[model samples]
Target chain A: MSGRSHDIPEEVQVLAGEYVLGALDEAEMLAVRRRAAADPELAAAIAAWERRLAPLADAVPPVAPPDELWARIAAAVAPVPQEAAERPPLHAPAEPLVPWARPVRPPPRRIWPWQLATAASLALAAGLAAFALLPRPVPPVEMAALTPPDAAAPGFLVTARPDGSVVLTAAAPAPVPAGRDMELWVLPKGASAPASLGVLPASGMRMVLPTPPAPGTQIMVSLEPKGGSPTGKPTGPVLYAGTFGALSP
Target chain B: MADARTADEPTALLRQVAAGDRVAFRRLYDLQAPRLYAVALRITRQGPLAADAVHDAFLQVWRNAGRFDAARGPAEAWLLGLVRYRALDIARRGGREVSADDLDLPEPADDGPDALEVLAGSRDAAALHACLRQLEAERRRLVLLAFVDGLSHSEVAERVGMPLGTVKSWIRRSLQSLRLCLEGAA
Candidate 1:
């Protein structure tokens, strides 16, 4: 930011340029986006570039999409009807509607180098004084970074203690809309369903779990209705997820 | 395009889409999907992924159409941005990067001055097309390949056979110059 070029900084200009040219990977894009959101000048620069380069799209030849493509899009975008606060169904449901979704491994995520770099910058900046506050990682104290599959930036970092307690800390949390809350879920090995691990603390929180999870257990955060998902299962898309692993040596 | 509606129809259709008008949404998809799909296809190089990008983009447009203020830019530009982001993401998620040489499709025949001006109908598009024409040939090609084909800085450097630093500088300069030209033209 110091020793700037003209009025705006050179690195920011480069960021806006990279964003427009699509030269940046997700991690860089995310970093620029976080900045542009707060800085109007950067946003204006980006918008101008988007407008200027938009015409280049004319050169691309239009190809017809598949016949059923519209159907798929329509189904995906249909608004989820709001639940009635007071009125129960006229007829009692025959059974509980707990959907048994197979917790399939999500597509391999693209963790951009810059995203890792951002997190590493934080850890390095903290140095020893910060490390003094953090618990020592012993044989049973494992940590994991929970990054959502669709995320462009960093995600939450969690350190699990051998005594079934965990400290969940937010790195770059995915934004949740108003009237919505982020719910954490744990899918332990050999479990048929994901157990609710309470809401993710905005900053960071330490909570004792009923049992210590095994290594390699997957952790997920989903955007649920206000409070949490009405159903026991995830009613919304899983925004961020990552598996548990040993702390960095 | 098939219906001979004015260029403004896309903006109108998007407004309707925001209101949950399914039929209007269908027409919007019919009108714009091909171009969006083509953009995605160019970047993803796979039919399924390209289709997914388009589908995801349209859904995003439907959900966020209300946020589209025509005053910002054209509907086509807005929609194209969505699809372009989606396509780039798909390419990255699949760990698939296609160099210029690896592409099997023929390059856009009009990779020169007035490449975009001929099709431009809006003042912004026309201004941009003119500004692009002012850039040097190599810088323009770099911009096109990077934006259109969704190549990264390193990929563009390898494709253009230039050093990475040179590519970055040219792109940064090209962007600044283009912004200046467009503003002056306006």
Candidate 2:
């Protein structure tokens, strides 16, 4: 269906709103889902609705869950095969059925953002060093860096860095439908609105925003239509969001 | 009863969970599970189903703990989102739907004007409770059905024995009114 120029249709907005409120029926919900996949405008509207009505979920009081529930779930989604195989045997009791009798111990510390960023930098430097020792071919000058959220693996990179300018280089390729683009978002601390950096390619291509965002700010990428976010702020699930720790001179 | 430590916030506990701290996850579960379970029970109505939903939700918490982004919303909202989605998914699967008769919640104590006065001890929570009291009986029922029972429009209509259209409009208007009432109280 054809959409109006420069504005989302009122009916679409209402539908999106209801969908966010969980008021729509199963059929209506499916229709919204299909449209959201194809239409960026509808997706943005639905995201806005999700944010507004999210607070209502907090109105209900909490209840404690049964003990066996967590264990059942843990058994289902355990990451490693060896871990999964070892789980039941580890938990199976030899004598008494009193599972709560065993003393509990804490798990290991998680990988912090700083640690992940440092690791990525080291890996990048190592790769560059390997390249430097091998070929005499001229290296590309301008580079753009795409860092994922702290502690997350670097999903993409930027190759063309010119003083303040940068280009997005996809580390791992992502699928993008025709006529759609990935818009970058710069979310500063204490700022509600995410600033649009520019549109990026699904694979890897070059597009530069006004300039690199302020240091220590979170850089995010969300899928948007050709021109970018109409609302001037992100209205999509953050695909890649990370901070800029240091820029190479 | 273990004295709940107020020093560590939910975010801190979540961070610990992200680091693979199972004990911290258990502590976090203890701190927040009661309210989340209450929500699930209210929505699912059947105790076992609610328990199942809560179980899945916390397991999601454990597995996807690393995905917790503090910038989007609070730890409680994130956790509650998981529960709300799970409860709705269960309701959609046609396990057991909450009926209005199933939701015969005790009427707020009618201490007349002194109700608000007595609630002053916990002003914020009291304000919310008072505003909830201000809603018309039917509207309050609708809110409870939507928030607790996780009933969609048609389900609410079925429970209340009202026309689906009427139930939908009532819920929308009631939510708007409640938002205004709570804002005014604040």
Candidate 3:
């Protein structure tokens, strides 16, 4: 065997360290990122250096970010609920008014059709809030009643219209505590992540969907930070849920 | 470094996050974001930029949680790495407002245990501490300034009042030495 082995050149090793150290300039940084994606040798070197220097983070003191920062992050990732698209922007920017609520996860069980009338009161109660935002009512093409798994009474009602909008009405001024916002989510059957429907207002609000939800899609309500679930899904306990079946004309 | 349990919990969370579990994603974020924010703050030295960096990093994590490979490193390190790179990108693009004159080395003694002392005590990081201690003090500080403070090569030179070439060579030599030492210790 030859005395010399094919070791990574010293130049590449140092370059990896420089990249990991955050010592590379903009052009070099971008170049490294691009190259690392396709270059296994370079990628391995970068990963190794990252592992080596990661402990240095312990040396930097942890600083708590301002509360609004999380809200912005959540809002960024949360899907633009179709309802939000049609509604005019709030006159003043809505400052998160409440502290983050403790998140409640949804039970594994599914929603049943028997609970429809049980939640009709919630839809009726939300009509006042809905009327204020939506000038006139278009007949709903599809509807789902959101009810907490633990309770027999439905807490909210959702309806889809031919115009591809979804409306949510609350049973009463949903005992939403201060500092919390109730956000809506939809988990299509067989999917892993739920998409944000948008934050529900005090009574009821109308939203336009980018496309009508498919049958067997589950609509849910989750307690979240003021803006929404920062991670783009349900971060809080799922308060209620109902399923949409085959579209009815 | 965190204990095995503490470290493993985030790894498990990342796995769940990869599987599209939002609860795990939020739990992971809650556990990691503060530290990540601080790391970004040190690099950018600007609140808004740091927040932006943290924000972008979390979004990437949400989108690419599947990329995390537990066999390679701890989840915390992987997370810190993501924010650090993002902060550096933002800091560079935004143009660092803090000049070299105002740059302060980490305080020797502050509210808690000294950072270096804490580093020394960490089981996973002890070898790194030992390896770092082997370097000359100036070289050691250069590595920390570059890695923790997110200084670029030119910026490190400006901060230490060294020429750009000398700073580059010193950093390269220091890294090589540290790498050799770490590998030997490992």
Candidate 4:
């Protein structure tokens, strides 16, 4: 361990202490979070504050949570099933190809006026094919609903289009700190790296996010200390999560 | 059944909770809930929210039991931190923002003697509580904020209307003083 000056600066220690106590404003809070992610020393300092202050819980009397709360939390935390396993099997007609069939050959012909017209039509078709191969914009589609894990309830509705733009409208209000921000994450099944959609507005009403991943991706909300995750992945507890399944064509 | 032995040491119970022992967690809860609840209730001054704070705090302890480091602090401090953080989080969310004027310090209860009395029969707890009592008023408040209200130094500053710098210095000096006091007692 480094000396108080070198290992953990006294100023940063104080900042970490304040952070653990919930004292910094939104901006200072964000700076501390970023520092904590990069600096293990600062994190340890904050953790120390957590330990020192943890004993004060002795002041309050304990009350059991409602029986339904645990069940609700468990349901929310449950993992969502992926598509390959859940999709219905498709039954389609199959065509058989023959190996011994004779190949048809066209007769050698002169270039006539009608043949010239036919050549022009073929050239036009090739040009159209080239045009089709070029990149084009995909239109956005409205995201209908986000289904919670275990099919317990629809927690939020997302409206998004092909342009990579999305809007998250919470069907129910979520508890969020006044100075802190809620962050949205897309947790693909079995994936450890949760893609951050963006910061969620605390109002629990409506907020727009950058382009989301394709449908059937699991969406999660975490109570970030402030700004957003200093690390790209979630470092806080996930508050709510649901999967956005594909809508019928 | 023969005379049941009181599981005197908290560390043993904490070890069980760490191992996913629900029965142990319940016992731990039964052991610590009163004090934890009192802490939350004092800060928030709302019964239902205080209950929520306790629930959230215990749930966190259940989930993060493996993260406990005995070298950093005792089991009681760690659990208190959980409840305090949860209560502070609730406070920041504006669940119930009671001003200092609104604080109603309950009279010391006379319910068949207090926790200190029961623990005084034991050596370690008695020594620890005695050491804690030796801290100055400001330092004691800081400890309470950290353990009971779950207020970070910044939150403490906001609640007390002091500058962040002053609050930070107070907490550090207070901790240092408490450490010295505990060492002397030990």
lDDT of 2 at A94: 23
Please tell me what DockQ candidate 2 reaches. Answer: 0.13
lDDT of 1 by residue, B27-64 (tens): 88888899889888888765545766787788788779
lDDT agreement with native, every candidate: 0.66, 0.54, 0.69, 0.52
Q: Over 4 Å off in model 1, which ranges?
A: A1-14, A79-249, B1-5, B98-124
- RMSD value for candidate 4: 24.0
Query: Of the candidates numbered 2 and 3, which has the greater lDDT value?
Result: 3
lDDT of 4 by residue, A1-249 (tens): 223324666666667666665554456666887889999888778776665434333334454432222222222222224542354522111212111111111112211111222332343334332332333322223355554445555556665422223456566645577766777765543343555645666433332221123334567777776777666567787777755545524
Candidate 3 lDDT, B36-152, residue by residue in tens? 998897887655457667877888888889999987778888998889988898677643453322333343232223556769877788989889888888888888888877889
Candidate 3 vs candidate 4, DockQ winner: 3
The reply for model 4, stretches above 4 Å from the true place, is A1-9, A12-38, A46-56, A59-249, B1-32, B69-73, B98-147, B150-168, B179-186
What TM-score do all the candidates reach, one by one?
0.56, 0.46, 0.59, 0.44
Model 2 spans > 4 angstroms off: A1-22, A28-63, A77-79, A82-249, B1-8, B97-135, B178-186
TM-score of the second chain, each candidate in turn, equals 0.85, 0.73, 0.88, 0.60
TM-score of chain A of 1: 0.43
Of candidate 2 chain B, the 10-residue stretch with the lowest lDDT total is B107-116
Local accuracy of candidate 1 as per-residue lDDT tens digits, A11-98: 6666787897799877777787898899987876676566667777777778886543554455344433344223353223222221
lDDT by residue for model 2 (A175-232), tens: 6667666776555433445555455545544432222223444567877766665565
Docking class of 1: acceptable
